[model samples]
Target chain A: MSLLSNSAVEKNMDLAPAPLKKEKVKMKKGLQLFLIALPFLILVFVFSYLPLYGWSYAFFNFRPGIPLSQSEFVGFQWFKSIISNPTQTAEVMRVMKNTLAISALGVITSVLPVTFAIFLTEIKASWYKRIVQVLTTLPNFISWVLVYSVAFAIFSTNNGLLNHVLTDLGIIDTGVNYLASDNHTWLSMCMWNVWKTLGWSAIMYLAAITNIDPELYEAAKVDGAGRFRRIWHITVPGLMSTYFVLLLLQIANFINNGMEQYYVFQNAINKDHIEVLDLYVYNIGMLGTNFSFATAISMLKSIVSVFLLFFANKMSKILRGESII
Target chain B: MAESILIKKKTKKEKENSRSTKGEIVFNFFNMAFFALITFICIFPFYYLFVNTISNNDLSSRGMVIFLPKGIHFTNYLQVLRLEGLGRAAIISLSRTLIGTILTVFGCALLGFIFTQKQMWGRKFWYRFVVITMYFNAGIIPWFIIMMNLKLTNNFLAYILPAVIQPFFVILVKTYIESIPAAIQESAELDGAGTMTVFFKIIMPLSKPILATITVFAAVNQWNSFIDTLFLMTDSKLYTLQFVLYRYMNQLSSLANIIRGSQGGSSISASIANMQTPTSVRMTVSMIIITPIILVYPIFQRFFVKGIIMGAVKG
Candidate 1:
């Protein structure tokens, strides 16, 4: 009876979906998936992969309506010319400095406000939290153009609100032309950046904080830890991973000091402080019609940013023992 | 459960205990005051904008408008609407945003469905392809060139086509889809349902939460997009709301020039004394531009909150 039972079990196992049937199923599934994916692959290749070929134009004298064969392929010529021209080089460097300064300030101001917002959410007042949430997010939906116009109205030299208030309060003898001064432009831009982004950035941190295990907070309280201590120990540490990831992402975009705000804000007076790489590209490529030089400059920015992103990723992995990439 | 009762009793005890601690009382007072102050500053700008929008144009020009409007003048709003190109531009912007949102949400959903299937061949390669595009784009020049070559310039398609299938949204949707249990899919497959039916009938219904999220995101992005219109839409009729606002501001500056010139030799400065095209007009214009979005936001605010949280937490 035992021998018969063993033989029957062996036979059942052999009859159960043979290896060849399994292989066929796997192959069919693979083919079905490929068929579904083929359309997106083609779309991406045409739109995304094809444009990569034009990156070579940075080294050439690129012209509209000229075939690749007809266009002059002067290797590294435009790059060398841009570096050699003192005016062009100075403009690039100045914009780079401004971009860094504004972006750094944006990052600093944004982090503090968002952190403060997350802390405020812990307070017992639901109405206060609700109102703060609404106000912070309201500015984000407003267009940058409108924000600039508002700034213009409020900061105009002769009849601005700030000036009127200051003069009325006897804080100043004359109304200062806040927008006209180069020193104030960068600061104003930083404030605008913070205004636009603070609430939105805080949302992510707040979400992350909510996900923290309640047990940790309870344990901290049981150990006689106050609100600040609990926040410093439990909340901040719980948020460290998210903070690092977001920080790395922000650092990766360090060169992209906003284009629209700077473009709209640019005037004869505040041009020095407001000009950034994006505005520089728009001026040279689109406005000036020097496509080749602009491409070269953009290529340089891209290369540097890619390197920085990779380096930051590596450093993050080392520090957190986790890879965001 | 025990902890809750203990915490309640402890809170009562702590309230009695804190009656003796002046330092604690002072600290709590300052904490509450500080938060209240921060909240006020955060909210004051929007209040200022709203008051400026409704206040008298002359009063706004004189910088006398402060916390509240002296008189409500809807005339500035009427003026903005009557501006030469405002109405047409608003319609164009609305239609484009609507169409773009629909197309983007659909395309992203389809792409996400394809990506989430584990049985797909070269899935890794395809996923990486999408992610690479998300990270690196050829910037604006090449994109503009492609649109021109495609004969998309001056067409509404120029605004909608390039943005219709963003890879990041696809990846987000795909991740959400991946979180769905595979067992459910297996049962549907065993019931002899085709891939399309399974996707449409099963996956989509289950993915409504994420679908709601991406829809709001796509809508907001399309509403805010102005650069594409500026670059691609050379025709005045094709201008979006943002582009229209931009032109209005430019026109204001030019009008300021003309008014100043026409009032030549006047003791009263033309730019200052005109009072017709004051800061209030700009504020009114802004309010008009954002009115639709603000009204629509609350409707989708819940979905937006959930979606944003999901994407951030998962990523």
Candidate 2:
């Protein structure tokens, strides 16, 4: 069982409690622990579950400060609109297409981290390796807003360095507006993600590399394997298992292409190519202020996500011999 | 360092087992060239921004300050520092990161301690209560409405209180707490110490690594956060440095306003007008925004690496 959850770890323990002798004392101790945990329980209920109660707004015609009883309860109307209304269904199709495309790119590049960890293992210079790893991983901590600044500083059409360089070299008389054009949105965003996360993603693979019994390398050396042969035979095989397990987890989260990066990069010109499902929900809810419609869309997304998670968990158990959750 | 040396010595032995081919030299050279290019790709943007931020506005604005800074000047930085409400925003960001990290860490650790008591009543049920939130949420609209109902919109408490009940951190702390010898807490109880006393006097001291790690995580999250402020802090007075930097980057009018508001007498306003645009100033402000995170990064990096590894590093 993973330590990421207490309930899972507790469930892993099969020991049965001693009964009968000190029942009253055990009850008192239980009450004490329960008292201490009450505040946390209440906090979770208020912040986490309370919004769950507000999900009822998807059924009712919710307005600010109005009682649900007073509002019109339209059962499954919004949910039905998801499939019935032509424009809404088309919008959903577009967002789903974008989400699946972006997520596919992300899953495909997940292999690159394993490539990175292997390359890192081969580097002979400790200082240089450390420098490269440090520089690459540092971007992971930076916020998207700050990242957008860096992107803008180098890529912005007006007074941008890239434009200046291309124009000066006579490659083009007029500057190309890369950011404003929707032509290469998917590829550009994927590359940006790879740049930002390359080192960060490789970290778990590095950890797995450290766990590779060094004796395997010694054994391979005894068998006359060269560097390339050893990396191919031993390191790749070991790392691929971890990568596939992680990929299974990603498959479960297929729809959750986070909205922040797209939100920052989005504009009138690029929004058509970049808007994914999560961003669509956010825009419709937060920007457009259609609370009920947005909630219905998200409720559907969440339900699908839960089912996907369950299927992935079952697949992981079959493949890896355990469930993640 | 040791790993590299060990692997290198192994390579030497392995080479003796099989003759080294002449083609290997060319392959190694190309491999080295490939890595160098990648390293350039990773670090060049930030370095270019640094150079541009320091170069003279005339040179930078025309995009002539590419490879290095020329006619270095601090005028842009000075103007950014003098921007209206920059000082106040810095204060808000600093206090929120500090207090928010402290409260969230202690609160999570405390709740974590309780859950680890093994004998706790309905422990599994209560644990799931927190854990289940990780899987499901009420979506953004309902959350925003709830935040409004709590009357926390524009309140500083909105930032601190919402983060204080992090179930993920609670689970992390609980995992560490469970590893501590039950004998220590048992003996403390034998000596008639209460739960709080045992937690503070015994468990807290022993859990330093986890506490420090959680603190760094929470502090960085708080410092980097502008989403909460964006949704809730409509009041200009509550803006943090992140929010300010975000505005300066996104909106051209906001950049113009920063210069006009920081008017610093007629001479500064005259210089600002003469400058034509604040593109370099935007770069300077963004540089200022990110400098603190980059500076303290190395100190907290080890903890972050450990956290990432434990969290499975799924990007």
DockQ, structure candidate 2: 0.39
Error of 2 at B75 (Å): 2.8
| Stretches of candidate 2 exceeding 4 Å from the true structure | A1-26, A63-70, B1-29, B264-276, B313-315
Model 1: per-residue Cα lDDT over A231-304, one tens digit each: 88988888878888888878878887758888777877888888888787877788787887877877777778
Best by DockQ: 2
What's the lDDT for residue A62 in model 2?
A: 67
Which CAPRI category fits model 2? acceptable
Docking category for candidate 1? acceptable
Error of 1 at B156 (Å): 1.5
- lDDT per residue, candidate 2, A206-317, as tens digits? 8899888899999998887888899999999888778877898788889888777887788889898799887898888877867788888777777788888889889988
Error of 2 at A107 (Å): 0.5
Give the residue spans of candidate 1 off by over 4 A: A1-39, A63-69, A170-175, B1-16, B19-25, B253-280
Reference-based lDDT, each prediction: 0.74, 0.80
| DockQ of the candidate models in sequence | 0.29, 0.39
